[model samples]
Target: MHIVLQIGSEITRPTFWLIGPVGKAVFYYLAAVAILVFLAGASERVKRYTKGDADHADRLDDLPSRVVESARTVLSNRTLFDRDFVGGVMHLLVMWGFLTLLIATIILGIDMDLYRPLTGESFFIGDFYLSYSFVADAMGLLFIVGLGIMLYRRYAARNERLWGHHTSLEDDLLVWTLFLLGVGGYLTEAVRIIGQDFPPFETASFVGWAVALIIAAVGVTPELARTLYPITWWAHALLALAFIAAIPMGKPFHMLSSFANVVTRDGDAGKRLPGIPADLDATNAETIDDFSWKELLDQDACTKCGRCSSVCPAKASDRPLDPRNVILDLKTYREERDAGGEDLPIIADGGAAVIDAATMESCMACMACMDSCPVEIEHLSSFTKMNRQLVDQGDVDSNVQNVFQNVMQQGNTFGDQARARADWTAELEFEVDDARETEVEFLWYVGDYPSYDDRNKQVARSLARLFELAGVEYGILYEDEVYDGNDVRRIGEEFLFLEQAGTLVDTFEACEFEKIVCTDPHSFNTFKNEYPEVDFAEFADDPMMAFEIEESWDGAPVYHWTQVVEELVDDGRLGLQGDELAYTVTYHDPCHLGRYNDEYEAPRELVRATGCKLVEMPRNRNDSFCCGGGGGGLWTDFDDEPKPSEERLREALEDTSAGDAIEKFVVACPMCMTMYEDGRKTGGYEDEIQIVDVAELLIEAVEIRDGRQA
Candidate 1:
C-alpha cells in the first residue's frame, strides 16, 4: 500500500518492528522507572535540608516576587553572565537547548498518546507540526554544539575554574553522559529521516535531512536504513532514560538544587549573618541540624565552580581556608550521615573533620566569597556559625579571645578607657560641640581606631576640620559613645556585640542629633544595618548600660563620612580652595563600604572632586581586595607571609609604578588606613607611596585653596 503524506506529516517514522503496542509499552515502562528513581533520589537529598535550623523563612512571605526573581536569575543567568561572561554564554546556550528539547519531548508524548488516539488524527501534522519539527531539529543540533564546547572547556581548555582542584568521577560522569545522550539523539533522528519517505516540507528539519542525504549518497538502501532505525531508536531511548535517572545521583543534581537555591536566596545579602540565639551559653551547631535549612541547601547548590575560592583573600594569601573545599566537605559529610555512617564530628580531635579549625579561622568575613558565588551561597554565614561553635568550646585564637575580652571590659577592642575616646578633638582648630550636652544636626561617631590610634587620630582631626569648613552642624558624643561593635559581632562574640550596641543606642537616644555619621565604614555598616534588632532588655540593668540617653532608639539614620562629604561637595557647602596637588592617587575600597553596603561611588566621587588624578586599582568597587583588617584581623594576626593588606598595597604600587606612579593610596576606612600604613612600610613601598584617608586628602586640598600650609 502507498503511504499518504499529509501536510507537514507527523508520521515521519513507521511503526516498530516488534509491533507498535510492544514498542510503546516498553518506552512507557522505562520512562516510569527512570522518573521513579529520579524522584526517590531527589526526595532523600531534600530530607537532609530539614535537619538544618530554620532560616530565611521570610523568603517565602512574598512568594510571587521570589518566583519572578528566581525565574529572571535562571533565564537571564545574570549572576554568571555579569561575573564571567564567556563561561556564562557557554552555560546559557546549553541550558536553553536542554530546556527546549525537554519541551519538545513532552509535546511529542502528548501528540502520540493523547491527541492522535482521541481525535484519530495527529495534532503535530500540519504547518504547526512542520514548525515544531524544524525547531526540535535545530535545538537538537544546538544542544550538541553546546555539549561539544563543554567537553572542550573541561578537557582541551582545562579551564582553571573547573579543573586543578578536587574534581571527582561524578563530575566526569555528568559531562560524558550528556555528551553521549546528545550524540545518540542526533543519530536516531538521522536514521529515522533516512528510513522514512518524508515530504519536502519535512526537510525543514535541516540537520536530520542533511544526515539522511549523506546516508543516501553512501548507497544505503531504504530497507537497510529501516533495519538500522529500530536499533538507533532503542539506544537513544535507553540513553535518555539513563540520563534522567542520573539527575539526582551526582553533580548533575545541581540542575534542580541550584534553581531551588536561587528562588530561596536571602533577600538582603548585606544582612546575611543571623543573630545569635538569646541564650549566651547555648551550644553552637555541632551537626548539620545546627545550621539553617538555607545553609544546608547551600551544600547541594554549590556547583563546585571554585569561584568562591578564586576570590577568597585567605586562599590567595596561602591561608588554610579553601571555600570550595569547605562546602564540598560539608556535602560529603551530609552524604555520609545520610548513608547511615556514624555522626561525624564537624571538628574532631584526630578523625577527619567536616572542616578543620584553621580553615574556619582563616575566613576574613569580607563577603567576597558570597559576592562571587553565582548561586548566592551563604559561605560567610557558614564560617561565622562554625566559629561560634569554636568560640563556645574555647578553641578560638588567642588574639581573637583578647579582642573579645577588651570589648567586653573596656567597650573598645584596644582596652582604652571611655574618657580617651575624644582625645582626637584636642588638636582641632575649632571647638567641636559635645552632642551629649547639646543638639546637633550630625553626630560624629568616632569609631575605635579613629578615636584611639595615633595615625588614625590625624585622619579624625582632618575630618573634623572638613566638617567645620562645610559649616556642618556636627558634634561628638565624646566619652559617652562606646564601640559600635561591628568587628566584635563578626568575631563571633554576639552577646558582647549586643551589649555594646545597646549601650551606644541608648546614648544616641539621649543625644539630640538628627543623623549619625562616622569616618569608619565598620561603624557605618553596623549602625545602619544591624542595630535595629538589638534587644534592650538584656542590657537594661547592666553597668555597661550607664549611658544617660532615655528616648526610644529605633536606629536613627546613619551615613559614612564619604557619603557626607559627597553631599557637601554636591551642595557646594565645601569650597575647594588650594592648587590641585600634583599627585597620582589610587583609592582602596574597604570591604564594608564597597560590598557589604554597596557604597562605591561616593568615595570615588569625593576623591575625584578634590582634583586629584584618581587611578583605580585592578580590583576596585565590589571586587576590591580586602586589607585583612576586617573580621578582627586588625587585632588577630595570622602567620600569612604576605598579609592581605600588603598584597593589596603591592597591587596598587604595581599599577602606579610605570607612570607618574601612585603618590598616595587614599583610603576611607580607619581599619584600611591602619592595614595599608603597615603594608607601606612592610612591602618596601614607603618611599614610592604614602597612605592617606579621603578626608585627609580633601582637607589638604581645602587648606591649599585657603593659601595655608596643608
Candidate 2:
C-alpha cells in the first residue's frame, strides 16, 4: 500500500506511516479490542432500554416519517439551538465535522485494507484522493475548533448549562480525548509531510500542509521528523480507538442515544402521555426496571444542557427540583441497578440523592424542561410516572393530596357540592343549557377552576353571555360533569384520573352534543386525547360516545373555548371591530393550551378579532413561560414565593406602555386567569398590567356591538 501510494505522485498521504508489519498488526489488534469494548457497553445500554415496555405506539408507527424527521432534526440542529445560538453553531461544527471524518476513515479503511487488497484496483488516488485529502483536513480543523469552544465554555467561561448539578471526570475525559485526537491527526500529517520531501501535491492536505510549514520553520530536520513520526502516528491512532471505546462510557453516548430518542419521539408526548401498562402499578419506581423502555432511553439520552432547569418554573422560584437533576438521578439509579445495587427510594431528598421529595413536588408540571430539551427526553412524562409512584406510596404533599381527594370525592377540585358547578350561570341574565337533556353543538365540560373559583367564575359567566348573544348552541354538563382528570393524571393520581375520566366518558355517552369544549386547557387536553383510552367497561357497548368518534369534527375533537370563539368572531356575528375596544394587551399562553395542543394561534386570532392590539411577551407561544397553574400547581405552593406566574407578569409588563397603559394580560385558560390574577397582585404589577381572560375580552366586544346597535 505504501509503495502503491508513493508511486502515485503523493497527492494523498499513506494510510500508515514509518510502521513495519508488527506495528500494523498491533494497530489492528487494538482496533478489534476497541470495537469489542464499544459493542459490549452499547449493547448493555440498549438492552436496558428494551427491558422496559416496547408498546410505545409512536415508536415505530411511522418509521419512514420518523427517520426523515430525525434526519431533518439532526441536520438542522433546531432543538440544539433552541435558546443558545453559539452552542448551536458549536454543536453543528463538531457534529458534521466528526461525522465527515468518521466517513473518510471508513472509506480509507475499505480502500486500503479491504477493497483494494482484494480487487487489486485503486480508485482512491487522483482527483478523489486530492479532494478527499483537502476535505478531511478541513473537517478535522473544524472539529478541533468546536472542541476548543466547548472546553472553554466548560472550564473557562463556566457555562452553567454545561456544569450544572453534576460534572464527572469521564465528561472531561471524553471532550479532551476528542480535542487531542483532532490535534494529533494534524500533527501526524505534518510529520508525514516532513518525511515525504514536501511533495507539491501535498498542498491538497491544506491544513496539514500549513502545519508542516510551521513544524519545518521551527528547525526540525526531515531525518528528525522521520524519527518522531511513529510516536505521533500511534498516538493519533490510539486516540481514535479510545474515542470509539469511550463512547457509551461517558457523555459521548448522547451522539447515538439522543438521535434515537429524537427519531422515536412522541409528537404529543407531554400533551398525551403514555398509559401505564396493565402489569405495572404507580409506586415510586424503586428501580429502573419499573420505567417503560422509552423512559429508560430518555434517561440515557440527556445531554445535561440544563435548558430544562433554566426554563423550569419551580427551579426559578427557589424550589428544590432541578429538571436536569431528575434525569441524572434516574440515570445514576439505573447505573446502580446495573451494578447489582438493591432498590431504594430515588426521590427522598437530603441524603446522597440526585432528586428529593421537594424536587419531585417542585415541578409545576409546566413541561418547560421537556420543550426546551434538545434531545426530546420526555422529562415531564417520566417525572409524572414517578409522581404516580409517590402518590401510591403516600409520599405526596398535603396540599396535592387534598387536590386528589377533592377531585375524586366531590367531582371537582373545590370539594363543593356538584350543584355548585352550575351556580356560576345564575349570575348571567340568560340560562345555560344542560347538555344531557338538550342537543347542542358544543358539550361544555365546565372544569372545576372555571366553575368554582370566584375570579374565574366571572370569566365563565361572561363567556356564557357572549355565547348566548352570538346565538351559539353550547351546553354544559352542569352538575354531572366531573373533573377532566388531565392534571389529575399528570399529578400522578392514575386511579383517581381513571375513575373521574370513566365517569365523564359515561356522561359523554348520554349527552347529545357534537363536540366537547372547555375553558380549561387541562380539561380540553384530556378529553381530546385521553378520554377515549379509558377502559369504560360500563360504556363499552356504545358504538360511539359523545366525546369519542365525533363525526362533525375530526377524531376526538376537543377545543379550548378560544378556538370556538375564534370561529364565532370570524363569522362576524359578534361584530368585533379591533378599533371598537382597542386595548394594547399582551397574551399569556397556557402551558396545556400552547405547548401541549399547538393551539397558540387560535387565542391570538380571537384577540385580533376583538380589536385588541395583541402585544406579545418575549416568551410567547410554544416558548411561553408557565403561569404556575398546571399539574398540582393550582392546589399547591412548593416555592417559598410563587414565581412562575409573577415572573410571567413581569415579562408581560416589558411589552407594554407604548403610548397608553397596557390594558390587560389576556389569557385563554381559566387556570391562567387564576394564576396571573394572583401574580398581578403579589408581583405588585396590578396597576401596570391587568389580567383578563380571552372570554372577558370577547364579552366586552359583544357589549360594544350591542351599544352601537342600540
Candidate 3:
C-alpha cells in the first residue's frame, strides 16, 4: 500500500510535469543535431552514388513511365506481394499513419503544452477534437499492428530473404523494444484518460478506457494508474526519438528514398539504349569522365528487398550473381573505403570478403535486376560500369578477346563465315547497297540473323513483299552493315561495340535513304540509340534524315515488323488476304521487344488484325516470360545445358492451346522465331506447331488472298 501511494504521489504531483519541459528542450536539440549530421552524411553519400556526376542522365520525363512499369510489375511478380501482404500493407499504413500522427504529435506539443497550458481547446477544431483524436488514435493503433506483424514475421515466421544472414537475435531484440514502446504509449493514454476529467473523450478513447478497465479489474487504484502514466509516456517518447535517429543506418532508410528514386526513374521506353561513344564524342565527354561521389552513394538507395534476386534469371539458373547481394557488396565496399580513409580498391578491397570473378561471370547481362528494383537503383548499369573498370583498369578476366575474335574473323557470335552474312538477301531482286544512287525511300537494315539464317529468310522475304506492296523504295545495308554489337557492349566489350557502331554510323551518313527500318529490335535499339552519338556526340542522334522528317523517310524509324504491319493495316495500305491461315494463336513477349521497347500493344494489335483467332498467355506483354535468347545468351553455351528456348517454347505452346487448335506460333523477333523453331523440334512439338514471324503471317494472309506475298 505504501509503494502504491508513493507511485501515486509522483504521478499526481505537478512537479512530474517538469519532465515534459526539460525533456522537450533536450530532445529537440538532439533531434536538430541528428538531422544536421544525417543530412551531411546522406548528401555526401548521394554524391558518391552518382560518382560526382551531377548530370543525372535518369531523364525525369521517364518517371511516369517507370511508375507505370512498376505498377505493371505488381501483378506479374505476385510472389513478393503474396509472401508479405500483411507485413507490406501494415508497413504502408505505418508509413502513412506516422505522417498523420506527426501532425497530431506536433499539435500536442505546441498547443497543449507550449502555447497555453491546460487550455484544452487549442486543437484545429476545438470541440470536435474527437475526430482528430480518433484519426490519430486509430492510425497509431494501425502503426502498432503493422509493427507487430513485422515483428512476428521477423522472429516467428522465418522468412528466408529477410533472415538470409541469420541476424535473428539482434533483430528480435529490436522488434521487442519497438513492441514495448507501443505498449507503453497505449498504457500511458489509458492512465491519462482514467485520471483526467476531460470531456469529448468518451467513445474516442476506446482503447484507453478498455485499458483502464483492465487495470481496475486487476485491483489497481487510480493512484497507481496515475503514477505509471508519466514514466510510460517519457519512455515512449524516447523510443520514437531513437527510431528516427536510427533511420539513416538501416534498410528502413529506403522508406524515405524509394519513392524519390521511383519518381526519377527512366521514362522513355522509346529512348534507345545509348552505346559507347567514339573519338570526337570523347572530346565532349566530361560528364562520363568525372563520375561524382554521389554515383557511389546510389548503394544507399537499395532497400535490400531481394525482389531483384528472386526474378534474376542468372541466379535462377544456378549462377553466382545475386543482385541483392551485389548491392550489399557495394554498400559494404563503400563503408569500408570511407571508414578506412583509403581509396576504394580496384577489386572491392577487403580480405576474404571481396566479390570474385566466378560471381560476376554468373550475370548474363539480362538487366532484369534493374527492371525489378523498387528504388530504381540501376544495378545493371552499375555492374557493367564495374566490369568496365575491372577489364580496362584492373586487368580482370573477361570474354572480351573472344568477342573481338568472333567479330573480326566470323562477323558473328556463331563464328559463321562473314561472306554468308548476306546469303538470305541473295535472291532479292533489288540491289543490297547502292549509296551512289542516293535516292531510296527506306533503308532496311537486314541484320545478321534475317540476312543469314534460313529460317529467318522468310521474314526477310515478307519485308520485301510488304515494301513492294506499299510502293516504299527501301535499300538494304547488306555487306555494309556489320553487327551493331549492343549485346557485346553490355557484356563488357565496350571497345568493339564502339568500333562497330562507328562504322554503322559512317555508312548511314553516306546513304541517301530517307528512312531506315530493321526487323531486329537489337539492331533498332543500337542504330537509333547508339549510332546517333556519332553525330551529336552529346545527345541521341536522330536516325531519320531531313527528307524522312519532311517526307517522313531518312532516320532509322525502327519498329517491330508487327508495328509496321499494324500501321499499314490502319492506313488501309495492307489487309489480311484469305481465311485459310486462320487459327487460334498466342503471342509471346520477347524481353527486348516487350519490356525493353514498350511494343506490347502493337504486336498484339498486328496479331488481331491478321484475322486469326487470338488467345492470351498467362504471362503476356510486360509480364511476358523471357525466351532465353537475350543478352548474348542465344549464342553462348550455358554449362552444356539444353537451350532456354526449349522451356520457353514449351510454355508458349501450352498457352496457345497448341495441342487443341493452334497450328502456328507468331513471333516478331528473329531470335525468338529461331528459338521457337528449335523449341518445337526439341520439345517434340514440331509436328504440332510451326513458328513464324508476324511478317510471315501477314505474307501468308496476303499471298492466300492476293496471290502475291504482300
For all candidates, the clash counts are 3, 3, 34
Candidate 3's error at 40, in angstroms? 5.9
lDDT of each: 0.80, 0.80, 0.61
Clashing pairs in 1: 577-705, 578-704, 578-705
Instruction: State the lDDT of candidate 2 residue by residue for 515-558, as single tens digits.
Output: 87888888888778776655555333444322342222123478
| Higher-scoring candidate on lDDT, 2 or 3 | 2
The alpha-carbon deviation from the true structure for residue 231 of candidate 2, after best TM-score superposition, in angstroms, is: 1.0
Clashes of 3: 34
Off by over 4 Å in 3: 1-91, 112-121, 148-184, 197-202, 210-220, 268-294, 341-353, 393-400, 409-419, 427-438, 534-556, 577-580, 640-644, 653-663, 677-689, 707-710
Q: What TM-score does structure 2 among the candidates reach?
A: 0.94
* RMSD, every candidate, angstroms: 2.8, 3.4, 6.6
Candidate 1: lDDT over CA atoms? 0.80
- Give the RMSD in angstroms, all C-alphas superposed, for model 3: 6.6
Inter-residue clash pairs, candidate 2? 283-389, 284-389, 578-611
Cα displacement (angstroms), candidate 2, residue 297, comes to 1.2
